[model samples]
Target: MVFLDEPTTGLDPDARQEFWKLVSSLKQQGCSVLLTTHYMDEAQRLCDRLLLLLQGQVIDQGTPEELIERTVGDEVVEIAGIDELQLQGLTRQADTWYRPFGDGYVVALPTQRSLLWEQLGSLQPQRLTRRRANLEDVFLHLTGKVLQ
Candidate 1:
């Protein structure tokens, strides 16, 4: 077993890739690795299972895909630069779940995505983006905070 805590912090991108290759090789050799990292991308790529911590307490644990599916759903929709009234109106929509993010909201889209787009269009947000939900989204949904 090998233990690493934030092992790749501050490394250049090329170096980071090299480090990941090393870790992958170790796993391929059947070595068990325990790694700690603030980089969600790294965690998602390298780990088979993850333990999420908040305020030094374990808040959740699962495979990366399981965590994202359980917390943020299939898609993420972000609407930014909207006023308070628009935010209020959106919150009232049934079957939609959202949380306040910087200058806007992060919405976890339901299985029915078409209705969500229609509702968002009615609001005419200054900026809107839709993307597949990812580990970062899960982290934000679970902790209400962004990792620096």
Candidate 2:
């Protein structure tokens, strides 16, 4: 068994990749690895199961896919460059889960892109993007805070 806490925190990208390879090899050899990391991508790629902690409390635990599906669904729509009034109006109008992101909000959708488009078309957001929900989205949704 191996315990690693933020093992790749400051390593260069190449070094991180090498460490991931080593961890994968250990798993293949039937070694138990316990790893803690703030990098959601690393956790998603290297772990079969995950325990999410916030403020020293266990908030949720599951496989990466399971956690994402349960918390934020499969798709996220980002609407940016809107003012506070517009944001509030959109929040009230859209009947979905949303959270504040960079300069706008990220809305979680359950594969219904048309609904969002129809509503957001007239708003003329500076940037609009749709993407598959990931572990970071799950973390944001669960904790209501972005990981630093």
Clashes of each: 0, 0
lDDT of 2 by residue, 1-148 (tens): 9999999999999999999999999999999999999999999999999999999999999999999988888888888876656655664555556778888888776554445655665678898888899999998888895321
Candidate 1's C-alpha lDDT? 0.83
User: What's model 2's TM-score?
Assistant: 0.88
> Which digits, one per residue and each the tens of the lDDT, describe model 1 over residues 1-148?
9999999999999999999999999999999999999999999999999999999999899999999888877888888876756655565564556778778888777765447676776777888998898898888878884211
Error of 1 at 83 (Å): 2.2
Q: Which residue pairs clash within candidate 1?
A: none
Residue 46, candidate 2: C-alpha displacement in angstroms: 0.7
Positional deviation of residue 103's Cα in model 2 after best superposition, in angstroms: 2.7
